[model samples]
Target: MAGQNLTTSIIIPANNEAIWISACLEAVLASERLEQAEILVVANGCTDNTVDIAERYVKLAEAKKWSMRVFDLQIGDKLHALNVGDRHATGDVRIYLDADVQVSNRVLHQIERALDREEAGWASGKLRMAAASRVSRAYGRFWSRVPFMAKSVPGSGLFAVNKAGRERWGDFPNIISDDMYVRLLFKPRERYGVPGTYVWPIAEGWRNLIKVRRRQNKGVEQIAERYGHLLKNEDKGAFDRKQIASVALAYPIGFFVYATVSLIVRFTKDQSGEAWSRGR
Candidate 1:
């Protein structure tokens, strides 16, 4: 498919993300090169001014000749918002973006070129964490060196798939790790890591960091228990013990912080409200 002919649908599921949604929309709108696109911000179960702020951008999006919609729902479930957004998205290339993450203007074009290949099933750009604190930056350095992190396409905060790739995995299951599920659906050969980077904020503060890590561990456990077969095709390289040692040796404090969080989460039990209150 020609890059210009491909339409992109960017779906952002937001819940009380009023502080971040406007900037998220702005970064996307700056892409400037898309021939046709629709930006859907599903502001569900928002108690703050998320919807009001998002609604303020509909006119701006229209002014730029881009189709944009902000759906306000009474409930605040991420899965519910994603399912709703998917139904209304009409573009051939569907991008699932987190309200807190920001992508470069060339990201959509990169995805277009990657998906132009018939064999490309799902794709995502490289993830770069914007951690301001020294502790968080050290942790990010260690986290980025893990074997799988360096090798395969890490499709955590932002990812996209063409129509054919979307058909491989239909509606997302009501699970916490929707990203992992999508990443595992296709074999390594079918996934593409396009050039460019998307900036994702690292959870700041010790409490918030642990909370996020615990939620992530819980999601991985859920995927392992329910979709073990799918993981065989994850396309990750072998775990390197030396690389782990090198990271830990160079950044002991960060490694200790990360390991402490992992250990705590290992002993924790899943709560009913985990999905809704994953972080602050």
Candidate 2:
């Protein structure tokens, strides 16, 4: 597998993710098939010790025969961090990883195998939400069964692109929904959803859940307002009426909790100066 000639670049955009960045980088260092991978952790406007923690992994990265660098930026924008990381990266396969998300050792291999095909464009693994609170668990139960979440690689936390796939869109546009923007860039046929699981933790409390949901909804609205044409390819595995009904019937409590949170976020004014929820 080392002779396969695939060089992967993992770009993680972190903003005050000191709590989770260490574990996330440890998972990368533990990867089995990612011997030739280069990891770039872009710490953006972090007031905490994110950069320091990430720097601790440099020696481990070198020992593992992989390159890991930490880039500290003053701006807090995630898109800018991605662009900076991409500029410094020189891998044929680029992986966009969230600082709080963790993937299996086989995930890199899965992504590489999927992108090995000439027709493959972008790719990601299946998502599994990790939640402990009752509120978060209820929300996750219903949200996980949604058709799109169940079938497609939501790429909210983990996603990858090959060289040809990266060519489809240049630098990421200034958008809050960077994941959605990238997902909509290609048609469903152009992307591959590898069979593996990645961790996407739901925010802990009801209030935190609402905060995250509001931010997500706002991102979707921004994309629709600026890039409406891209919406044509957005429904890769969108839920059908029947599927939605079935989920509601099967998990009525969970659906009610999720819907209530959505309604509150939709009607409430967008909170300014809110801190980023790392789903801790």
Candidate 3:
């Protein structure tokens, strides 16, 4: 299967990501391995130029005789958009990429090679925060080390799957982190993480970081509530204790320390400026 002609469908789900969509599409178009693949951009409930950007790429794909499709859906969630895209795909392999991330041809080829293996059901790539700020870089580094942190998996933004796997999983679960849900459906060995596959930097601000943490907590709560019965035979006490300590104790402590220091520094800078102004 090394040199086999594989039909890969790349599905990009966008909400209001007009600013980065063009760049993402450009990278996809430039990938030699993907030249014969179908690129589908599912613009769901986007109240911006996302649709227009996708349309432009569709025209470019057509002019180059590359297969492309742009589907407009009213779904407001990422999972819904992905399901819509997957339904329209006509490839033996389905590749999921975000609208804001850019992937290199080398990385794409690596993923393709991994999928060429008969035993590979799902293939993910190493996620590198491209040109991220200091805080984002730190977060990415910390996340990359956690084995249970599904977000670090390539399935978060860039993932490739065989048609059989997609059919078995049906569609992405309607949740904040649908990638994690999909990963849980498979045995750990069924998911392969290929190195050198990366995504572009995430635009992270302090507020955005807080929002993401909160959303993650909510997703965790949902998962626990829905799957708590699965842990009935395990040591439920230890599991609960660890979960509580991590979420209730550790995270809040870190958040408070960081916020307190940031606020103190801001206040100190403001006072220094006032003193200088008064002296002048």
Q: What clash count goes with each model?
A: 0, 0, 0
In angstroms, how far off is 75's CA in candidate 1?
Answer: 1.3
Ranked candidates (lDDT, high to low) = 2, 1, 3
Q: What are the RMSD figures for all models against the true structure?
A: 2.2, 2.2, 9.5
> Candidate 1, which segments miss by more than 4 Å at Cα?
1-4, 117-120, 267-280
Q: List the residue pairs that clash in candidate 1.
A: none
Residue-level error in angstroms, candidate 2, position 146: 0.8
| lDDT tens digits, residue span 20-105, model 3 | 89989998887765555889899888778788878988778887677898877786677889989988898777888988888876
Model number with the top lDDT: 2
Order candidates by TM-score, high to low: 2, 1, 3
The whole-model C-alpha lDDT of candidate 1 against the native structure comes to 0.82
For residues 1-280, write the lDDT of model 1, one tens digit per residue.
Answer: 4434788899999999977887788888887577688999998899999999998899988987999999999988888999999999998888999998888888877876677644447899988877767666666776777767777788778888888888886678989899999988888888889887888887776666777777777688899999999989876676567877888898788788777767766786646354445343
CA lDDT of every candidate? 0.82, 0.86, 0.66
What TM-score does candidate 1 reach?
Answer: 0.92
Which of the two, 2 or 3, has more TM-score? 2
Tens digit of lDDT per residue, candidate 2, span 121-197?
88998888999899899999999898778766788898898888888888888888999999888888888888777
Question: Regarding TM-score, does 1 or 2 come out ahead?
Answer: 2
